[model samples]
Target chain A: MKLSKLAMVTVAAAMVGGTPALADLVFPSLSYRTGPYAAGGIPFADGYADYFTLLNERDGGINGVEARVLECETGYNTQKGVECYESTKGEGSLLYQPLSTGITYQLIPKATADGIPVHSMGYGRTSAANGKIFSHVFNYPGTYWDAASIIVNHILDENGGDVKGKKIALVYHNSAYGKEPIRTLEELAKKHGYELTLIPVDHPGQEQKSQWLQIRRERPDYVLMWGWGVMNQVAIKEAANIRFPMENFIGVWWSASENDVLPAGEGANGYKAVTFHGVGSDFPVFDDIKKHVVDTGKAAGAGDQIGTVLYNRGLYAAMLAAEAARTAQALHNTKDLTPAQMRDGMEALKIDAARLEELGLPGFGPEINVSCENHGGPGLGAIQQWNASDGTWTLINDFGPADRAVIDPLIMEDSLAFAKENNIPERCN
Target chain B: MSPDFLNFIETVLNGLMTGVMYSLVALGFVLIFKASGIFNFAQGVMALFAALTLVGLQTGQVPFAHLINAVLGTDVHHWGPGLPTVLAILVTMLVMIALAFLIEKVVLKHLVNQEPIILFMATIGLAYFLEGTGDLMWGADVKALDVGLPSGGSFWWEDVTRNWAPAGSDYFGMYIDTLDVSAAIIAVVLVVALTLFSQYTATGRALRAVADDHQAALSVGISLRSIWVIVWSIAGFVALVAGIMWGAKSGVQFSLSLIALKALPVLILGGFTSIPGAIVGGLIIGVGEKLAEAYVGPLVGGAVENWFAYMVALAFLLFRPQGLYGEKIIERI
Candidate 1:
């Protein structure tokens, strides 16, 4: 009987040991590397994956527990992205970066209910920057409204800070992502006394001749492009043909990329755009990539593309995800964490320059702090101009403070109304 | 009152230019409908694929040297100026021809004598298949198509005297986009050439003969198979030109297929079989919608342009069941 009891205990121990360890943290990467948006998606995915790999290699895991990133390709479709979220949410996913506005909209309600964080970064419902109703959704740096204000300000400054009686046309992609900035522009136009003409370009933005022809006839003083993929290049070429001063044109960040301008070559010279983050080889994280990721033979892109616009965006996104996990680990005694712990960790996280420097990203812009009331902590960015001759982008202005005074109250008022409508629970403050 | 009337006239004129572009695509539909009763839904995708291929060749994504070396067993590392453009166009044309041939051989050959509706559904399947294949081949980056077309306007309209006078007002003046005007001119030329060929040429006549009575034409010793190939080839060439013009205007992306859908209302407005009707219908829809959006759209809270073309076509359909130039039916059943 003693021998039998001992054998039974051994069997029970073996079964317990064989059972898979519950993952400390689960992060789902909603990637789109194979679809219409793949040109932008592929590099972003590569950078995201490399950063996670770097953390694993250098940190020996976040706080002694390894970090796991589960990737699901969504092909940039919202339905597919939501399906991926449902399939992976059960795995204790700490956060989701859908990288798509449509997907973010669909996931917002579910994410709030499930208490999982959704980090949209530069894209998604701009109104969700309100930390109240969209408590789960975080659009850090700035929202589309912030981007529009900056672009309009830059144009005003270029035209001597008086845009009254000027005609400004917006040739935008017809999607939620493109339409996000229109309301802000209209408000700004009303305040500033400028004429705003809205032209909606259907998806994939091929066939803009008629639109450009209208520009030629109407001769708007300034043209703001909210385009993506080939739409950017097409607009540039069309503007160039019509002899529209390239200097008078501004593109949203998504519309401004090396791929967009490089194809146009000399034609896209003097085009300007607003950037939420620093560009090119200026950031300190690039050095870390060279030493840790590239030197280790794990970097996923060509060596030259390490600090390109989209690549840096992907790097920044990964940094945010890793920092959230690190913050979570700091709170919990054990490094191994659950999604709830990560959520709590993200809410309390503070990422300043000193923190960035210590983390080997000294050149990364000012710190971002997340709280119950402010999901977009660093609502600041500078404008960059593309010089076709040098094949480079240069910072033209520092982050101007004028936009904030206008944007803050709007964010608060909108967030409050949204909270009321969505039945969002009041914050503890 | 004068300024208001001038603005009204300007908006109408602007709408006409828009209509011309819509007509170009619609004409492709009419051409295919004339030769084979099937509405080629893949026409828009064909335009996108052709344009992307042209741009890709110019940029040397997959070097022309490599393509030529692989094909001709040459060691050439560099090619001559504009050679890539020419070769890419040739290759695209050949691909389109092969596509037309394959479409006939694989799909249409099986559905011979089937209802027009069935053939239309098949073309829709072909549309999805072509879109996927085009994406696979070109990797879905929007590409700028440079078909050696000029895009700027001339100094004649910009002169001070021309600018000041009411008749010479920038609004009233013929300050046409050289590229769009070229596209319009090319479209007109193609339509004329097609019309003449159909009337004067033997093979064209044989194709028309086949269109008129397939069984009777077959009995008269004209091979339906050969005639089908000829008509599809002509349609394929016309599609290539349409693709080039539209692709140059917009970057060649998958969304070009939707522009092909704009041809549907054009087909409905113009009789499905009337070439002239397609042109007229396309022009009407294009110009009409833009004018509506510019003036009437503000009254309706904007976005009226999106549904205006369909509404106009629907209204026409309700009044004239046979279409503007469609054949009058004489039912035997």
Candidate 2:
């Protein structure tokens, strides 16, 4: 009942997964390129399509097989996302990047049943980091909780390692996506003895006058935002309107897109956000994409979006998926991979700094290894500051590691609760 | 005044300003519902389409950039130098008028005397069609609509109110977005214009006659088709002004349509058929939600603004279902 991905998902899903042999490695992009969230979706989808297109053009595809990328627009609606997943699961599907937490939640069960893998990536089911419970689902690099913990760690570092009396306000999106960090933030707030204010802005957060007014009244020491789409722009403007220190605000990665900042114009300067990968269009991997994909006029989206934050994240996600498919190919020693083979390949995945350097994505990621026991890799992150003078983002700090001590317990607790309720047996570590 | 009292006054002011925005959209709803007895669910989408058209025109962006590029294999995002804001608005108005005629000719004419629910459903379909058309024409990317309207908080207002802070208290001066103040003025002017148009003009009289009794008005030499077209055109104008204001405030995007949802509680509270009801209902909901969110919301962990309006409208319905200014429902069975 969430949304209709329509008749397309079934037809696509029917084609690839149910078959034994397929020429190309097929993956479905549960994209929302036309909605309130299209600003975020368009860039990510473009990056995704481009990076894979680069693979086909530059490297002749992953492991000598041209990757077949199909996109079904979800409008960020879960039903549509599920439709995309179900429809494309049959097209010799390797994996899914639902890109939405809600859709990932729905697909986790179905993907397990179908033996196809679901990669929620950075945005969904933080607890799916528990590979034992979510065998076919992967949320690697980091989870929202990992993100929340990194922000907290950064705050602790910012405060000269003491935050006993400071007040922190979390202005969040009021959905599952926004609520992801609340539990972890509360835990950190108690541990650090910092006062915490939780303010939830309803979706499409255009009107946040009252919320900013409250912040003005309370005057918290720091404010963290978990906003997306129009919410990010509105919140930034409101914060500036109320004279809230832009430097003090740290947004979730979703809030760190150019569309978010560009709408507010100069007011977006000095604002900061956490990112799992590097921001800016300066990555060398993008050169290969330009030379092979955009320059060749084969890019799936606007060539201008080649190096934006969300675009890079999309590129990064696609790279991971391609690598996973290659991993599966190498393990099975077969050019044609079944969904089960793809899952095994994804589980054995490893990407280090050297590998990243080899791939022209130096410093774009940290060492990442997914195992049967832990789907999430060493969840690494970095803080980036928006420099409006030049309209570019500068990474202000080296990539910080997500605090597993804080996140691991929550992941274990949630995944165990999920397993017990669903009668799922734990996988051997 | 104490800091607490100053904050309360400012919150109240914010609520009233927000009420003006809600009222603007609700006014469009009232005009159509009063004239045709059809609750136009497509009103919000109309506003969204209007805003997208304005931005598209303002930037000299080529319409159907995606489709044209796909079909012709040519990349052209803009045509030439952008139009003046005034010129773009004028062109957008003509487009809206054409849209009104198209809607009447294509959809509304066939359902001349249908049940209100069926008409409502038809408007919903119209909403979907217009929404898709808007995206297809404008491209789905978020567009910043800047016609050079002043935004951000009013420093003069803040400075003027600075003395109202209570002694030895944490008090920041009142903050208000200038756009909201302009919107308030525009809303008032719009109401005044509509009031005059409806009261004195010959076309206005015919419009009222149709609302009073469709068959009687038709018999008295007024063409129903013309009236329907005129009313829809007026609604389109209202939608255009609303679209410009909102698009200027927060870049033109898909979320522009959801503002129509806010107008609903205003409609229910003010009575669907009453023009003044749209304003009064918007104010009540706006002020009530703000107060509740500021005071009662904290008790419930905040975010009561989303539902408090509907709750108020629901309660109002129990006492007076016709709405605050709507005509009394009469039964003759």
Candidate 3:
């Protein structure tokens, strides 16, 4: 053998053999703590990190293995996100939770190629629900398609099971993340007779005067928004400016943060958004987090965003990842897990109501069960309304299923097209 | 009497109002550009930093609290009870003045007699540095700025205008944001004050002379360094006003810096050196973009206002390169 090749082989073997048995399970957080979207990203990054800290402090770790978070700031830019992914993926990274839809879309094929699982949870390409096509990408609990259907269902419920001839407008950000729900919404609009108006707001959406003005002129019965960052704040403010009923205004999960509504003050009262999880710091897990993670000064960022909406999401994502790690440990009969083993555990992961109660997050979110054929959990969501007076988002409805009749077909078509285009064979079969 | 006509008028009125908000930002750019030949790219970042300082001071937030906490392993966030809005604004003005002095000494002083592009590049660096420093000091969280500005629609005007629509027509009323109305009034006061300052005061005359010719102004016994500091301070104060209005409209956040994007087209169409042109150019772009978005946007996929302003600016550049009120660029060939 050549000297260089022999030396490389010896070094590789020794490194593999010398790898420590107690190495921490790595979770790379593609966080954007600086940028226009920092307001939304800060709380989320805090929550994610704090949850891992909680696991370390309160429970020793997930199944006796310490969980370490590798944070790389993306600045909410897609290129920066990809750069973060490349730089962090080599750190024995088990999974990725790219909070941005643009980043998630870019990471899907790349992560799949790298044998790592990406849990885009409630965001990203909705078709990833079809695990047959996208075995590595999981947007469990809910997808944008599910959120759209859930929103339509809530609207339908409000109108006594009918929204015939009613006008509904969608004020969406002009990007892939914003466009994900349009197809599902269109299908639902056809299934149930309703007029749909589409208004696209460009990125950063600092100015939406023209859009709100159009909404006023058209006077849609309900205005559904798919906005993020400052777009949400400006839209809510402009809606209030035009005297639009705050009750009729709804946003996607990304748009439901405190930053979005606090700017408009009392004017944002009664603003509703569809969420897959609970809001506020009422959960028992928060008490544990405060005691073990925050009070000890071992918290993530500031330690002030303990129970905010995005913070809770980050904590929930960590909990899911930790649970998946435990599941992987048990299935493989080993604590040291490979990224592929993590994918296996994620596929077989099941978090029932009892499991949630045991985890001290009772009634916080829908039960999730992952299988080979289903990467996205039972697509369920609830409606949350902002009460500007008390400064809290109250769950206005029970967690319910999305309109599967409309969503299933769309998912099938999109995923099938993606599978064909990428030459990816069905994996579940 | 036609509801469509009323809607058209309403669009124009709202357009004019939105235009005034754009002018608020553009005025700062014109102030700096007229006094010195540098197009201040940091004007938007200055507004963001000023608003952050105002919010931080009002809330009694300890400066660099996050960094301090991170470094010292402490949990300090606020220092004491919040300050009153007026007191906070006054304190914030002083901070902006100090920042102006520092910029003149540190950045502008060193870049004197350099190429205009070099000065512009310096402002870009200044913008990024200010944004990062603001984040490090106050943290990146969004904060609400009240300043007691009345927001939401003017109900009295809406009610009165509602009767103008046909009795049975769908046009409910003309919707105008009270905040936008207040911004227009403030913008007018600002422009008048600036005109009076430059046309009346000794320092203002020195500023105009410097804008006319930096070397000549220096030769005529005007202190160039003092003039730069004075103009930058005035620009900083203008940024504060713009910050208050925009911050009140939308919570003070990092996106406040992106308002510079909204001002770019206005600066292009309204000559780079004319304060009056900033206002007129803002109105033209605002009305034109709003009308296009309202009428032509629906036909095309909508969101045309994003680029419609730039398209108008491009057309203006094609016809009148110096802009409506910009001095004609004369060269001795």
Question: How many backbone collisions does model 3 have?
Answer: 0
- Which docking category, incorrect, acceptable, medium or high, applies to candidate 3? high
Error of 1 at A308 (Å): 4.3
Where does candidate 1 chain B have its weakest 10-residue lDDT segment? B156-165
How many angstroms is the interface RMSD of candidate 1?
4.0
Residue pairs in collision within model 3 = none
Number of residue pairs clashing in candidate 2, backbone atoms closer than 3 angstroms, sequence gap of 3 or more or interchain: 14
The global C-alpha lDDT for each of the candidates, from Candidate 1 onward, is 0.75, 0.87, 0.91
Computed on C-alphas against the true complex, the DockQ of each candidate is 0.25, 0.55, 0.83
Expressed as tens digits, the lDDT of each residue in B1-333 for candidate 2 is: 888888898899999998898999999999999989999999998999999999899889899887887688788888988889999999999999999899889988999888999999999999989998998889776677787778888999988888787655666688888988989999999999888998999999999999888999989899988888999999999998888787766678888888898899999999988889999898988898899889998999888897998999999999999988899979899
Runs with alpha carbons beyond 4 Å of true place in candidate 1 = A1-26, A33-38, A53-75, A156-179, A186-220, A228-234, A259-265, A281-308, A355-364, A400-402, B1-14, B63-82, B113-118, B160-174, B329-333
Which window of 10 residues has the lowest lDDT sum in candidate 2 chain A? A1-10
User: How does candidate 2 fare on TM-score?
Assistant: 0.95
lDDT of 1 by residue, A17-82 (tens): 985444555668899866557667766777777777777777766665566778898988989999
TM-score per candidate, chains pooled: 0.86, 0.95, 0.96
Worst 10 residues of 3 chain A by lDDT: A14-23
lDDT per residue for candidate 2 within A1-429, as digits (tens), equals: 323565667667777576544498887788888877887898899989888898888888887688988999999998888887777887877888988888888988898999999888788888989998989988888888988888888889988989999999999998888999999999888888999999999877877878998998899999999998788878887887777888999998988987777766788789999988987777688888888887777888758787788889999999999989888889989988899999998999999999999889998877889998889887888889999889899899988887777788999999999999999998855
Order of quality (DockQ): 3, 2, 1
Model 3 residue B156 distance off true place after TM-score fit, in angstroms? 1.6
lDDT of 3 by residue, A102-177 (tens): 8998999999999999999989888999999998999998999999999999999999999999999999999888
